[model samples]
Each structure stands twice: as structure tokens, then as C-alpha cells.
Target: MFIDASTNSLTVSHRPTNAPSGLIESLKQYPTANVGDAMDRLNLMDTGIASQWANGRCVGPALTVLTREGDNLAIHRALDDAEPGDVLVINALGGTTRAVFGDLLAEICLAKGIAGVIIDGLTRDRAAIKELGLPVWARGVSPAGPAKYGPGAVSVPVACGGTVVNPGDLITADDDGVAVIPVERAQSVLSRLADIDKFEEDLRVRIRNSAVHAAAPAMASTN
Candidate 1:
């Protein structure tokens, strides 16, 4: 089963099963920042290049995009193709000169129950985006406008920030960064990330009162 871009309808690959409970809870435990650490341990395969552009964190399934340079036709089509618990992933070819997402698009996403958007390009309408409280991660923000000509693809695998993201993969983004958990490996990865988070928490508690000393005598501060 697949989502048809023209009609904006959902078709399940399997039976409409609920997302894993542990995965959802793990998303709550580790903020986007801590997840980045986990991805680093996993060799960086489970991550996205998303810069935080809003207040809260975003964790949901992905709706991948492959768009032409300077045009967002594919992205618009992806939005129509996305499901309620979907995060739009746009492959913008690292173009940051023009804004690929803006107020109107965000409004449409919010109304349609989209989890958030992650673009490898620029975004505009900063004030409205913030006001609407939609999660957006992009290369940067720009006042420049975008073109409409589109020879784009939707629901296809696309490279974002040197990482390949496939449609329906789990995406988590927040103030720290973005991480992609492949649908097949999400459960195991979530468990590993949980253990890493716990260890970090313990380390933080131990380091609270510990004093650092320079190993090199020459580098030590002397009063």
C-alpha cells in the first residue's frame, strides 16, 4: 500500500498497527540533543540535518521529498501525500538562497495534522512560523522567495545532510538536532538510546561535585 500524491489519501503497507509504545516513550525521554549523541554512537546513520526553528520537539514518521532546485512543487505534493503522524523531509539540494517553507505552508501543515517539516534549504516567515508553533528545521531562514516550476518526486528516498532518509521512517527533531530511526530498526535503536541516556544521566550526577585537574603540569593554572 502507498499514499497517492494526487489524492492525499493513506494506504497502509500492513494492517494499521499502532506505533511502538516503547518508541513513543523513548522519544519523550531523550530530547533531540541527547538523540544526536546516540546517533553518533550508531555511526550517524540515524539522523537528519535539521536546525531547530521552533519551540517544541518533533517526533513522528517521515514523508520524504525530492524536489528540484529553487522549486517546492514536490514539497507541496508531499504535504498532500503525508499522513497525520508524518514529518515532511525535503531534499532541497542544500539550496539556502530562497525560502522553501513559509507561513502559508506551515498553516496548511498544521491544519492537516503534520508533525513537522525538515528541509535541506531555507525557510521564511519566521514571525508567523513561531507564532503558529509548528516545528520546522532547515539550513537557515531567508527573506528570498522560491520558484514554482516543479519536476519533483514525493515519497522517494532522498539524501538530507549526507544521510539517506526513506519514506515512513521515524524522525525526531528538537533544539539539539534531528535523528532518523529507520522503520525496521526503530525499536532496537530506541532501546539503545534509552540505555545511553541513562548512562549519561548517571555520569552527570557523578560529575556534579568532581573537580577537574590538568594532567599536564605546565597547563595547570597556578595562583
Candidate 2:
């Protein structure tokens, strides 16, 4: 429920239900690098979305929002509708002069159990967000605030950071970058990521044992 200050009344509405199961938790088991590798093997491109921070990781289904530049009412609406395992994916037309979100919003997301936030625009209060442990993947930061008015849509498809994101699509982000997996392909992608992780682990072991070096003479000769 939201308050209509103009009328001094409380407004109530139904919250949108989130996707039941996308194996969100399972996807969290693999880092974004492994997921990216799996996407490559599947002939998928445009999965990477750059992150402003290098330490935080997020995994969840997307709750997409598209808002006009310098306005954030749609982001608030999305926050209200987002479930515990939902990632707020906002497309602000790549606006950078004004911030679409900040630490106060991060606090609300934390309290609401939101998995994370990915914005194709700027955010503020970066230090506070990191201290609060809210995973945010954004392009830049600005001290400028936003206007509340919005002519935007929620739970709709949005282009974020050069990638098309649809509501309920599985999203994962880490130090490497962000990756989106179609909802229907989430399970298959998860399996493939696991295989990739295993193969990489084996390769790492072989490298540590000097086997890879022994098999490549030119590389050994350089050393």
C-alpha cells in the first residue's frame, strides 16, 4: 500500500507474484565467470553487463523496470513488487547525469529481501551501499538526485547495459560481470556452468602440476 499525499489517503494494490522456481539459489553456486563460459559454449552473446564494483555478487530472477531519464517512480514501484529472490533490473536509458538509486533505496531493498540491483544508469551513496552490503551493479555514480515523476513500466522487458532483460530472466553478477539466462534455459545453463567449473578446476590442477607447461614447448622455452 502506498500513500497518496495529495488526497491524504492510503492506496492498496496487489503485488505481482514472482516466478516460482528458477533455480536462483543453484545459480549462486557458480561465479559469473563460469556462467559466462557456459553462455559462450551455448553460442550466446551479450550476456555481460559491466559492474562498477568489483567485490559484490548477485544471483536472482530479474524484475525489470524501464524509467525515463532523471525519474525514478518506476524504480519505487518495482521495489514494492519485487520478491525476496528478485533482482531489480532498471534501464534508465543510460542516463548518467543523475542517480536513479542510492543508499536509502538500498536499505529498503535489504529490508524487503531483494537479491540485488542492476542499473544501466548512475547511483549515489556508493560507500553507504557497500557498507550496508547491498549488491549493486551500476555504470557510474553521481551526487545528483532524481525526480519522482515517471512515465515508465514495470515487469516489462528492458535493455540494461547493452543486454535485453525480461522479467523473470535469471541474472547473475560478480566481480567479473553480469550474465543473463533466459528463464526457460536456466536449468540447462546451470548444468553447463557446473561442467565448465569442473573442467576449469581440472585444468588448474594440471597447470599446477607442470603438465600443461610440459605439453607446450614454445611457452616453456619463453620461460
Candidate 3:
């Protein structure tokens, strides 16, 4: 895709090299918690960026977008180049007073086959977005609208919910929150997920077999 060089605002960066086919499906099998464990919890997005609807979960390559706080012209532009199953991982500087995008944009994501969106800023129209079944994780929602200005970039490295997201980084998100897995770490994380799953299952078995408070771990993040 051509990056439009005509304007100082609304710049574009190169897209990421694609990951293996079916990678998103493989990552989807594990929940965010297991993904976090596999990465030593260092790449997980902050808990503040949470699901806007119940039962929301998705995994896809990041199409990173960076915009000024409370603005979304670049977000609309990013969709033009989005491939099916791409997830828009947007960094909006965590602005809360106004929304960067809302249900109207989400409908576009659905039409484009985009997997979902994770925003470091806010959005409105939660009810309508929930009805659309387009997964969205954001800091919060506000009724306020956003400015439609440029000065943002698409397909660039961006920070969302405290995690540095590069284009093509795998975004694994669910009820628990989002985890970012750089392409380089994808294999290592996949390798460790099984061990984390097994250890967790074994602990569940232990808790089930025992009948006392002591059956639980001294400290556990599993609850």
C-alpha cells in the first residue's frame, strides 16, 4: 500500500511482515492470563483497557494507529488499508474527557472483517457497539465526541494501555484484558502456554480434591 506523502499530518508507516497462517486461531485457544504468564506478564496491556461488552474475545495482528488525544481522523483512515482479521491497536494518549471513536467506526470494522480494536483512549456508544458484536477494549467511554483532525499516523509502532505495540504484534484479548506478543516472542510464548495450562489444571485438581482453605495456594493470581 502506498503511504500518502502529500501531508505532514496523517502519515503512514510500513505494515508488519505477516505471521504464519492460523496463528491467530492458535493464540485464541489460550486466554489472556495464560498468554500473560507465557510472556512473564511484561507485555500485557494495562487492566484499564477492558472489554466494552460481555463475552468479548479476539486475536489478531496489530494495525497500530497513533493519534493525538481525543482525535480519530487517522483511525478512520487506517481502516482503508486494514486486512480482514486485523486488529486496530490504537494509541490515543489515554485521553478520557472525549472519545476517539465510537459505534459508527466499529460498524466499519465489522464490515471490513477486522477482528477488533484496542484503544488507549476512550470511546462512546457502548450500547450500540455491544449490539454490533465488534470486540472493543478501551480505557472507558464518554458521551463527548472527538475532533476530526489529522496529525496521526497509521501502521506505526504505538503504545496502547501502557504496552508498546508494533505492527503485526499479536493481540490476544478476552474478559481478562489484552496481551501483546511481539512476533519474535510468539514461538516462545506458544511453547510456554502448555506448561502454564498444565500447572493451572493441576492446581485446580488439588483445590478440588482438598476441602480446606489451606488447599488454595498461599498466594495466587488465578482467582
Candidate 4:
């Protein structure tokens, strides 16, 4: 996504995953597109890690999972320790040969009130995942299943979708893609987002007015 699934060890590191007070609420008001704009496009996951369902959006602190190439035992372990509103961000090493997640895991996340998932590798059960309405962004899907062996770590920084995601980073994802904001920088990012919002709103007004202006001459000539 490997080291052979047969040879992988397990490591777990627990750390604080809480974002700044009001940070989640502030972030919820913006989309990943706008957030990316605010960050000068430096904060986004790669375009390939896209939403598994239409209209899926999520904002929460990440609970990072670093797994051996083709195994997901660490993902299961991460789920056991997840807090409400945590987004399980797994670095599966980009191996798409097997699907490391599916509907059952989606169900578990939903039941546990976890925010969503982002995988650097692949997943399965596209239809069922959509049916459950769990927000997921992954490289793609595979019908093949994953190995459930240890040799993975939870709450540690790992690479995902061409970026390194640290545990407790604010993960904002949508149909457009995913963005990871370090918790320490979230409030600053929020302020920047407001400036971007204003700028975009002004641009949108101008864009719409230009459309109306462009159509007027045609309407006048037709009349």
C-alpha cells in the first residue's frame, strides 16, 4: 500500500488529539477547497485520495494509523481507541493490491461517532460505504481483502496521500479531497480562511455580474 504481512510488528503511541476550542466550529464553516486556497494550496492531500461518496465532507482531529504494507490490524486497534469526532487517517503505504477498508469498518466508525476516514491506499464496498453515509477519501478501491497482522503503529506520524499526517492534526476533507492542519496552526489558518472567504465572495460577485453583463447585449439585440 510491503513488508510481507507475515513479518510485520505492532506499536501503539497514545497522545493528545484535541484541537483548539472553537476550531472545529470555525473549520466547519469552510470547505477543503477554500481551506486549500487559504493555505496557498500547501495543506491538501494529493488529488488521487478522493471522496468515496458524493457530497462527503468531514472536519475532525486525526487519529493516525501507520500500518505495514498490506495489513489493517492497526486500523482495527485504532477504532477500539477512537474518540468521538476523531478522523482515522491511515497511511497504508499506497498499496492498492488489496482493500484495507470496507463497509463493516464504516459501520464501526459510524457507531462510534468517528468523523470519517482517509486512506492512502485503497478500500472496498463502495456501495455499502455510501449507503452507510460514512465520509471516506482513499486512493481507490479493490475487491481483494487485507491482512490482519500487527507491525503497525497508532498515533504516530505517517505519510498519506503524499503528505505526512501527525496524530491530532485537524483533518478537513470533502468530495474535493483532504486537508491536514496541524493543531497548533489551526487558529491562524482560521483567520486566513476568513480573508480568503471575503476575497472569494468579492470575486464571485464580480464573476456573476460579468455573466449578466455579457448576456445583456445579446438580450438587447434580440429584443
> Which of the numbered candidates is closest to the native, going by highest lDDT?
3
TM-score winner between candidates 2 and 3:
3
TM-score of model 1 (CA atoms): 0.78
Error of 4 at 74 (Å): 0.3
| Candidate with the larger lDDT of 2 and 4 | 4
lDDT of 2 at 83: 81
Which TM-score value belongs to model 2? Answer: 0.83
Q: Pick the TM-score winner.
A: 4
Residue-level lDDT of model 1, residues 1-223, one tens digit each, is: 1222342231222212336656665676677656666666432323345555546577887788777667776666666655676788888888867887788888888877888888888888977888898888888888997775666777777787677887777788777667777778777777777888789889987776353333345456452
Better of 3 and 4 by TM-score: 4
* lDDT at 43, model 1: 22
CA lDDT of each prediction against the hidden true structure: 0.71, 0.77, 0.87, 0.87
Candidate 3 differs from the real structure by a C-alpha RMSD in angstroms, to one decimal, of: 6.3
Minimal lDDT window, size 10, model 3: 1-10
Ten contiguous residues minimizing lDDT sum, candidate 2: 3-12
TM-score for candidate 4, please give it. 0.91
In model 3, where do residues sit more than 4 Å from their true spots? Answer: 1-8, 211-223
> Compared with the true structure, what per-residue lDDT tens digits does model 4 show for residues 116-214?
999999999999999988999999998998888767898899889988789899999988899988888888889999999999899999999999999
Checking candidate 3 for backbone clashes, the offending pairs are none
